[model samples]
Target: MASVTSAESGRLGTLPLGYYSCSEPGDAGGQAWIDLPDKHFTIGNGSTYHTDAGSGTYLLTGKRVIFTRGPMKGVRFERSGKVTLRWIDEDGKPGRVRCVRQASSV
Candidate 1:
């Protein structure tokens, strides 16, 4: 496989290079101060992403983002907005977890 530099990631990858937070809704009963469990990720160039668990390569095909390697291999998501991604289950159903782009990159 070819290596991709951080600067080249922007031109090679479909998604914007930056930090992202993936979260699932918490059962806080609508409490504002309650925090939802979130996972941090770095969307890097060359269709790559990194999390606390591991790093992975992804493929952006139209609106779908599919993980091709590493810990998240085989996981898939669909682009919900410019800065958001919604998980897609095996049955093609949208999942509760959502990943939102942050203001910075690694």
Candidate 2:
């Protein structure tokens, strides 16, 4: 079990540090750059090349990551791989935006 505040330090371990973009479920999902250990994250739209949109803090719970601050607060995502996550968009909706991790250089 892991505490919600420091989930990555416990059972979930470290999250892949870098950027993740959602291209499968259309443009609404956008992209995000996650910096672990620090728990800071940034979100941006496609046209902006993910330069900036909003910033926030996040926490991991089991296989899911919860955005805790900023405009994306309450957003939830579940890990699909070491570097992939599926964003759960809209409450009670049954689709997910596939966000793939990219090299930090991007």
Candidate 3:
């Protein structure tokens, strides 16, 4: 696999790099968090009972970003803002999320 070296590349237009939280309505238990950087990606939850860790390789095409490997393979993500992304699961469920450039220090 080719390592991501540049934050600004040819295909991926402009992607946010930071922490994102699930913001779908009625999703009170949606503790999922997704972190995307210049290179790889990480997905997890900080909930007390949910112990899960995930990582994957992803690439951007037009308005959609596809996870090519790992747990979220085939998931499609679209930019909602510089610090936000909305995505649909492989099962076709829709969701929206907001992110901050910085992670929580707590």
TM-score of each: 0.75, 0.57, 0.49
TM-score-better candidate, 2 vs 3: 2
Worst 10 residues of 1 by lDDT: 4-13
lDDT of 3 at 21: 44
lDDT of each: 0.76, 0.54, 0.47
| RMSD to truth, every model | 7.7, 9.7, 10.1
Which residue ranges in model 2 land beyond 4 Å of their true spot?
Answer: 1-14, 25-51, 92-94
lDDT of 3 by residue, 28-98 (tens): 57545444433223333321111135565666655566666666566666655565556665665545433
Task: Give one digit per residue, the lDDT tens place, for model 2 in 1-106.
Answer: 9453443344533456566655443344653433332222333332112225556666665677667676567767777778777767677232445666666543
lDDT of 1 by residue, 14-91 (tens): 788898777777666774323233456788878888877889899876677878998788888888788998889889
Q: What are the clashing pairs of model 1?
A: 9-45
Cα displacement (angstroms), candidate 1, residue 75, comes to 0.8
Candidate 3 clashes between residue pairs 3 or more apart in a chain or in different chains:
none
- Residue 80 of model 2 has an lDDT of 74
RMSD of 1: 7.7
Q: Name model 3 segments beyond 4 Å from true.
A: 1-10, 27-51, 89-106
